[model samples]
Target: MKQINSIEDNLEILEPFISGLNKYLEKSRSLSLFKKLPIRDDKENINDRLLEGSYLFSPCGVELRESECNSLALELIDLLKLHLTDRADEINTISDHLLNEKINPHSIILSTIKNEGNEIRKKIRQLNLPEDLFTFFLIYLARPFREQAASYLLEKIEKLIWLYGYCPVCGHWPVLAHINEESGERTLWCVCCNTKWKFKRTQCAFCLNENHESLEIISPVNEESYRIHACKKCKRYLKEIKSNNDAMNFQFDKMYLGTVPLDMIAEKQGYIQESILTVRYDNPAGNELLMYRQKAIKEKISIN
Candidate 1:
């Protein structure tokens, strides 16, 4: 509930709880690091203009197709899954270390699994990707400013938050994730980097609604400290909770989404969420009626 400047600030305040996410949420029942992966061509032959009035942008941005992203993401997730199990803590530890110094945040992501040891890479190698395409990944990992890439990626993802209404990373809509820390309680994990962001407990992520009638509380209502917030129009939900101790669970949204049974229960109660934290993270300028989007601004000529 303490106000923080940025997502990173919230993560800092919730550090102890994030560290303990592994223990509180058993990894066994958790979704694969690649949960809800889209098939490469899931949106094939569909026109995108239908949603243009809604201020939605394709996450691929003409660089790639939805299918291509899904395929690449699947490949990448496979890599993380192959290795994330035993090395989850190590990878996270190194990620935090790099975050501390703001070093090569992406490359500094410590993977205990050797690159050569990854099965996905072996499969990719077998595919014989063109040198340029294959090398792009290597360059991405070793980019000069990884934090820039992370920021760019994160910002780009924020845009897609509206399009698909799901976390760009895990592809899983949040169920009942908890922050598990004194400060980070009821925060969400970036479906991509698995980063955590502390959002206001009662506010709606899409429309920013706090009206009691518009929002519904689903499962885990019995926990006293936590409950689900669902917006019917937005088709999204997030968990909010109270905590007194500092928690070290890094598996923030993982455990939250793992409660499939609870998700079913919520869905049955006539409450549903198709996305998480998408609109809230993206640019205020990007929405329809912004300073740049105004028709007057478009027609006006420069006085200078």
Candidate 2:
């Protein structure tokens, strides 16, 4: 891994690819599927649920209408093939199999949300498609929906107390962390749904190890604002950005893209990325809330 001494140097190196990907993301966000989708509001006993380690919304509880799912999936697939010219051939092959086999796009979207990569890989193998490429594509295709849902639910829970390592909105692990320059407070940013939540600075985001001996920060030379919070116990690392100003306006997505070298460096050091799903099912209250929200979706009941 090449040593990235400055943010500008890193961004300059990845600018071309990042620019194209940003355009694709912008066009994808403008799809009609985001407009027509409904987001359920669930605020009943919100803090209690958080205390019980129950995420605000389970993937099963979030309703993705079949028509919208199919339309959005097809549109995203087309957009990827159009904007991402490098992957055009691969996208075409996967899209052909996905459509011709009459596979319900909603099922794949749900599976991706639930982090069922094995099922997706199985399907990809059956279709004779590239496993890693199609799996990433499916996740990218499902991103907008998760992000939209997160946007709707963020305000409802952002101020509430949530101490968990995973996302409160989507049950996904943090992809990035933001540290306040003045206060030294840490906020974990979710990879799947783009949600942000407050977390303890001394604790490891992956294993929640707070012994201080098992946790360490790896900072690149000449980079004051960037570092990696790594856990020796789990061997998982979270890339972090220290916010100097306008923390609310920080483009985490762009920062994440610009910091690819950080991932490479961390991986080279034998640290792995955090798991997609957190271990929340062990709590009965989490299970109860999951079951309740799922039932509400089935009954068409708007949770108040």
lDDT string for model 2 (23-79, tens) is: 655775665544344445466676667666667655555566677677767766776
- Model 1 scores worst on lDDT over the 10 consecutive residues at 108-117
lDDT of 1 by residue, 105-156 (tens): 2222211011221432343355443333233233223211222223333443
RMSD of each: 16.4, 7.2
* Model 2: colliding residue pairs: none
Model 1 gets an lDDT of 0.37
Instruction: Give me the displacement of residue 181 in model 1, in angstroms.
Output: 7.0
Model 1, C-alpha of 185: deviation from truth (Å): 5.8
Maximum-TM-score candidate: 2
